[model samples]
Target: MELLKVSGVNKAFGGLKALNDVNLTVNEGTVHAIIGPNGAGKSTLLNCFVGRLIPDTGTVMFADKSLIGLKAHQINQAGVSRVFQTPEIFGELSLLQNVMIPTMAKRDGEFALHAFKRLDKDAEIIDTALHSLEDVGLADKKDVIANSLSRGDKRRLELAMCLVQSPRLLLLDEPTAGMSRADTNNTIDLLKRIGEDHNITKVVIEHDMHVVFSLATTVSVLAQGTVICEGKPQDIKGDPRVQEAYLGGAHL
Candidate 1:
């Protein structure tokens, strides 16, 4: 059931160690969250997994393949996709077109420069893109310009774009970074539905305790570059170590 395995991971810059001996395993269909204080190296660890950073030492195995030396695109092709904290959709493009780019790349392996060439000519790719948008409840906004949509809709577009890739594992970095309470709750609901229906494992790095509690089946708390504690949400909520290190002694 383990789809991704990371062991003995370490990354450092100069004399400061960002991640030290970090070990994590993500099963095929579950939501795993990594929570920590501001400087606990959560983003650094995520970069290592998605090929944005090369660790000083570690082994990352995805679907039994070594992912150490692969480039970012190679990692994406190897069935892992990541969504950044900020929405990465192209503001100039329509919502549907933003999703179409990945769909075309997945199928044709290249970004054709001719806008005149209809990407929707491929029935399966178009169908998948539309379904992905529908999953995020943005199917009705397909023709809206990406920049014109609200912040929450932009996040939904980003999710739809990632979903079009059909990645086995999705890495989300604070999917609700700057949003209203209503928007944040909507995102949590979308993530829960995705976990249940898409069959994709998720590794989320979140600072919001509410979001973490709602979406994470398992939580790992990091402090000063190492894991301080890990367990189910209920146990983590009651753990003194987690509370002191990251939750500020509050039962979040």
Candidate 2:
């Protein structure tokens, strides 16, 4: 049950090749992690899946449908949701209001400021948004302004926003970045619980080995715009190529 597949994908920026013959498969309801050093094309590859960049050649399929040329919103409509490294939230809005926007977008197919005018009258959507906030432990602070939240809380809010969309696949780019160790561990627990509760497939691009080993059932290592090593966590840790990629052969 491959939920997402990338085969022979290639992307280049002028003289620099970002992704070269990259291929990846994410199974349904499992966490697949992509790891690499800086400039290794991890983010570039993610952008391709979400239509931010179209690969120069190859196929990207989601449940057998091609995702190469679809717009970002269209790809999102096809049940793919992305949470960026920086939390993408409506800073001026309340946390609940922030989550509500995506709920409306999921139902109405487009998001507009005018949609919030009708938000109060839509009890079902409000309830759904609240539930999403609760899942991420932000229900109590639902009224807090998004910009006022701490870094960790902002990330949780972003996850809630994505959850309201009921996406079948979630793409997370450095989900626990810029967090304290405590917050990072809490995020790992939250993600594991979300997997148990929602049964959503996740593809994560992360620099944190702890988060990766804790959540990823499968791992892919990219280097110099190519997938150099891929396997289970235990297998990947000992792979010489992965060790070299990260630490110049000193050991991961």
| Cα shift from native, residue 206, model 1 (Å) | 0.8
Model 2: pairs clashing at backbone N, Cα or C within 3 Å: none
lDDT (10s digit) by residue, model 2, range 1-252:
999999999999998999999989889988999999999999999999999999999999999999999999999999999999999999999999999889988987855567346658889889999999999999999999999999889999999999889899999999999888999999999999999999999999999999999999999999989999989999999998898888893333
lDDT for each residue of candidate 1 in 101-212, tens digit (9 for 90 to 100): 8887777664456667666686887788888899899999889899999888888899989988888999999999998898999899898888888888999999999999
lDDT of each: 0.88, 0.93
CA deviation > 4 Å runs, candidate 2: 111-117, 249-252
Report the Cα lDDT for candidate 2: 0.93
Candidate 1 structure lDDT:
0.88
* TM-score per candidate: 0.92, 0.95
